[model samples]
Target: MFHSPRPLVAAAAVPIAFGRAGVLRRPQPRFNLVVDLTQQPFSKRWWRGLATLTALVAGVSQLAPPLGALPAGTPVAEGSDQARQEAALAVGALSQGSATGLTMSEGPLARPIVSAPARQSRSLSLIVSPGDDLARLLGRNGVRVADALQAAALVRAEKALPAPGTTLSLRLGAPDGAGQRPIEHLQYRARLDLELVISGSDAGLTVERRQLGLDRTPLRIRGSVGGGLYWALRSAGASPTQAADYLQAIGGSLDVGSEVMPGDRFELVVAQAKSADGRTLSGGLLYAGLERSGGSDLSLVRVPLGGKLQWISETASPEPVRSGLLTPVAGPITSGFGGRMHPILRFIRMHKGVDYGAGWGAPIVAAADGQVIRAGWTGGYGRQVRIAHEGGLVTSYSHMSRIVAEGGFVRRGELIGYVGSSGLSTGPHLHYEVLKDGVPVNPLGVTMVSRPLVDNRLMAAVRARAKALRGL
Candidate 1:
């Protein structure tokens, strides 16, 4: 045990008494001593006295060992008579008040020992790379194999692991008795609005997921056709998906390749989900318009009608027009509308429509804007769909492998079904027909027209929405 020499210093001071005037008066021949054990050498007797005092101050039954027990180079010695004389002279000077104002410091070994500060844990930041998983990342960062595997299992169970290039915050504790530095905690962004935290010691682990309430902001973009429609939209901060939606909405009224010339202006409004930190998520176009140099401006808006999203014209009176119909399939005509020999029945019969020679599983789109009235298996036409258009005109598609648009209003160029050889057919092809007031007409010769407005109120609402989006 070690003890400071401050108590011994006070004990060596002279006594004081109070005088008649209530003032502190020192005794005759009073002196103050400041013994500096640090700077002056000491004899064996002095060392023994210090050891005895240390034992008494520590309340120990046994006295401390001599100062000779310390490491070599200590100033204390048993046979240094010169050192003893110097110490005696220092004590005599203190008694005579010769060192009243001097300060005495103890040797380095006689001072109180201080312990070093505690070690703190270190933190590391890591980024996930291509073809890397949680286990592999943790292993490479000096985590134990068992711990890495356990943490990976926990992350996989949540199914919220971040993609490549995501940053991960990790903390490593100090090395334990086994010389192993275990992971303290890890943090990662699981989604744009959610963050995942994994933490624990070697005893147990815990996982936490925090949600960030993000918001969706609507934006409007307007620009001229500088290089191309796609480039112009991209330059105006429109994503590829949003640009595609804009093109599809106005495809019925405008042809980008042939109709759009240089200096044609276009505008679009889109809604995008964004986090608090300005990270963009999914987005879609809400309205779009195109103004030609010398032609009518084409405007379209998306509206919620009958629990479904429908794109309609911005005009108040959307009348039946005859310019927006497209050919459903792209192939050569196999049969024309007229009397023909039935291949299966081996008899002459009147074919009311045309047949397209297309490969099996070829995409079949709508010819005009209309609503699907029938979508099911017909008598001679297996897997058929009939759509009612404007001017009391109806279009029917027969011999389809599958129907994608069922009982809904579909725009021109939107996929309706796939080509197949079903029912009374010779090979893989599509049987297409056009009808007027319940009478079958020649599909190849008949002109296609747009459908009339079903609900005036819906059209009015769509127009209002378009106006609002345009002003955004």
Candidate 2:
């Protein structure tokens, strides 16, 4: 190794001396290192040895007390500069400091360097599945992408999309939660990333599924009569349209107002719609069945006929039979069949049928199915309609109110005549009568056929048509 001159050193020490006058006097000490090889006659080898000893003693003295006791002409070695640097480094390593420094000036340090610990984990995750659009799913889950293109950009950046599989992952460098500021800590840890998964599989294809709940829809309502069938339906929240249809269904044979009794009840099956999120929107159809106390059970059925559905009476046949006549001007029937003797006639005339009392202009509905044979003002009864029945029976409505267009097949319940006191000893009352096989009989006592009498072939055809109409 090449030799170098001695290193120069300077030191200053101030001693505080106490004087007899009680005043403190500061005496400063000074030191400096100077090499004058030109003025020396000694060999370099001798100087080198001296310098090595001086360097050892000086360096060792740094770790001891009374550092100023070193000899007066202490020589420093050629590598004294490196030795001083090393000592300084050792002291620095023992002391705590703000700026971290490594002991690798020569090369990398031989000892393992320990680094500070991590405050939190940076891994974050987001889960997605099939049926979820990139933009929409991100938006709903508190992940934001400006638009479809931006969403695609995010997907591309993460290599996640389309096919159901693992999607995205991110190693964050800071602590985080939703809508929160991130911070660094030495003890806390968190993981963040996105995971895409296939929710379901069927026939070699992946599918997505979700569960949702729905709310109840509003109730429907309608018009009805008394605490009977109609009233029961109304209380059950049936709509007006439903009520009208129900009335039309049972109105034919059953007199709704008079037939229904107390304690009647009904049940219905309603249809409704649901939203994508499973919220009930509204309801529609109100199919129902009803039962009346002291009365009969009722049901509504849509009977098909020639590709069309029609409401038909289930309790009785839709057809009615006609076989009777009435006298004029019967305002209100003072007597009916099977009643006591007449108040005016006294001699027990034995009423053959129910009498309907009405004023001279009151119209009369046809009692049953028949054809009008005579319709005019006859000698005994003023205006009249004599309808001939299916079994050689004839009926007449006698009165002066007036007669409708005659000489045609009249259906049951058709208006035929008006009420009047003509050709009879009655004041505005209808003389109603029924005849069987051309013989007078009590109409109330006769049992009329419930259903229309049709040929077997025609009935079969009708049934087939009805079935087709019902689509069943």
Candidate 3:
């Protein structure tokens, strides 16, 4: 038993006051405890009470759960941007439509701290700046690094990520304890004809590509070759690729610069695709026509014939054999193949081949792709090389300075010999002769086979289509 003087314990009430402005002010609790011990200091009973309090606090701490690290969208320091943001968040906690706050869900330490929103989740507009990729845009806006990486990787799987200068609409879900918003849904224009929608859930992200409606039609354009055909097409709303392909399709022998006068009417039909809003996306040329007032019109079409797609001339005879022969040398005809006086012998005789007055030692290419059957020195034609082309058409090149190809196959335009007064020549010239079954024929004539003829039904179909394009 402890014998001591009695101690006094009392309860006090805090007084409330009213201001002169007629406002009621409530007083906060003033728990200023006063302990009056009537016994001497250092009592065993006092020590026992302190020990019990310490033990109770220790037990409570041991029963509590461990805490997880708080997620920070960015690094934080005093007087830093993060600090300012924290202050904003503090003020926003009391109001609606402000910076977000956090609320502990279930067990405080182990469970996640969900974002207690000021209002319902709404899609925020973010304009894609120049050179800003998906990951960079999302991360800069407080999205988790993990979520951004996952979304980007999924988009790259289908095609490259959307280019810059685009708009992305996103719905953000509640942020975790780490201040990063998880993506709820995102819509992006992956391409002119494609749209992508990305959705995120606890089970992970899912990506879907939706094809936009497209209107495909043949783009027929006709205009005068004012200034130039190329620029005229561009001025008439033709794409660069479409106009270039049209010129190339008609470039076999017809020169667009000199032959297509400014007065000529140029017509072009190209494959084009357009959006519902009338945005153009065009492909190569399908037909190119040149209408001339002085001469016959030139018309060309790219159509399938004999199981192969090939160029067809609508004006000229079908499959002209003249297209097969390539000029053996570059020079004007010095002598014709018909009867004429031989230049060297000075006598009237039949000239079997045409003579080309080329420069000395100039390159002489193969007339066409063929195998060299007869080469080396001949009777009168010095340094002669004879190559046999397909369809029994044999071409002989005489008066060459030297021969490089004696045997084996040679391609057209390959340097086979150099021009010189080798044999039967009085000057530096190339004597080109075309023979059919050992009989000399006109070298400039269409001396080869024609292309596979188009069927009657297919020709009718092509003609009808061309007529449709030619109509006003």
| Between candidates 1 and 3, the lDDT winner | 1
Give, for candidate 1, the lowest lDDT window spanning 10 residues.
95-104
Write down the TM-score of every candidate: 0.50, 0.32, 0.47
lDDT of 1 by residue, 241-342 (tens): 787677666665655555777799999888867888888776677888888896888888877765767677776355656664466776788899999998
Relative to the unseen true structure, what is the C-alpha lDDT of residue 431 in candidate 2, on a scale of 0 to 100?
69
What tens digits encode model 3's per-residue C-alpha lDDT throughout 194-282?
88999989998899988989887778898887887888989887787777666655554354444567788888888778888677777
Q: How well is each residue in 97-169 modelled by candidate 2, as lDDT tens digits?
A: 3133444544455544475445453444545476766556444433323332344454456454545443444
CA lDDT of each prediction against the hidden true structure: 0.77, 0.51, 0.75
Model 1 TM-score, all chains together:
0.50
TM-score of 3: 0.47
Off by over 4 Å in 1: 1-123, 129-133, 145-159, 175-181, 201-203, 213-215, 316-324, 327-366, 369-410, 415-445, 452-454
